[model samples]
Target: MRFEIQFSGHENIRSNHQKTIEITKESHLTPQGDCIVGVNASASCADLPRELKDKLKNSDSKITFSISVENYEFIIKGNGHQDLILTHEEDIVIRKSDFICPRTLAVKCDKASDLLPREMVELLRNPNTKGVFSITID
Candidate 1:
């Protein structure tokens, strides 16, 4: 399925409009019995919390996110790190090549009932977290 993910935040953080990703049951399933959906794009360093930006520059840090879809909710936690590729643009693009920086949480649930690929993207777009940018679906 295909879905568009948008990021919104304050002026300091450059928010990305709509980014798209495709998910499939066969491709997303992991050996640990989890479904993994990820998108890699860059966001402006300024968009990140001052502490988080500093931490990424110096070392890796754990970032947590809460995702909810209809009646299902799950938490995805992953390490955030600095991207080596510096961009001339102002926004930070979470690239598929990089596994860190705003990656979605690996969801653990009954895939058949809890979430579809499109629903997974919807959950990420509307996460229940503060300070971090809000996401919208389109």
Candidate 2:
């Protein structure tokens, strides 16, 4: 079976590099048996919860993730830095001490379907609508 996600929000957040951040895409199946999507956490540091910050700072930390969007949420039981891939087509080596600012997080999917709704795919392809997508898991 396949999972579908819808991302949408107009809130502007800045990254550590001072770039405007936004949610770019809804989650979708990848060739590597994973579901990947982008999130712009530019303003994350300013309001990041202390507990979450501590978890991210720890090298041995494994934090659980529950991303809620629309009427559904995906529960991921691990550190995003360790569990997700940074890119869709390439495997890059990331240092354990490396930090993830505002970026995409890839969630592994077992037997995830490659198909996606045509409309959703079109939205993803549109550059103008890049940062307001939200999610709904199926």
Q: TM-score for all predictions?
A: 0.31, 0.32
User: What is the C-alpha lDDT profile of model 2 across 1-138, one tens digit per residue?
Assistant: 122223432222111111111233333323332223333312222233444444444445444434343343334433334433233222111112233533333222111112323334334343333332222122
Summing lDDT over every window of 10 consecutive residues in candidate 2, give the lowest-scoring window: 13-22
Query: What is the lDDT for 96 in model 2?
Result: 23
Worst 10 residues of 1 by lDDT: 8-17
Which lDDT values do the candidates have, in the order given? 0.31, 0.30
What value does the lDDT take at residue 113 in candidate 1?
18
Per-residue lDDT tens digits of candidate 1, residues 38-119? 2222243334444444544332454434334446444434334444332222333322233433332111111221333444
Q: Candidate 1: which stretches are off by over 4 Å?
A: 1-43, 67-74, 82-117, 120-138
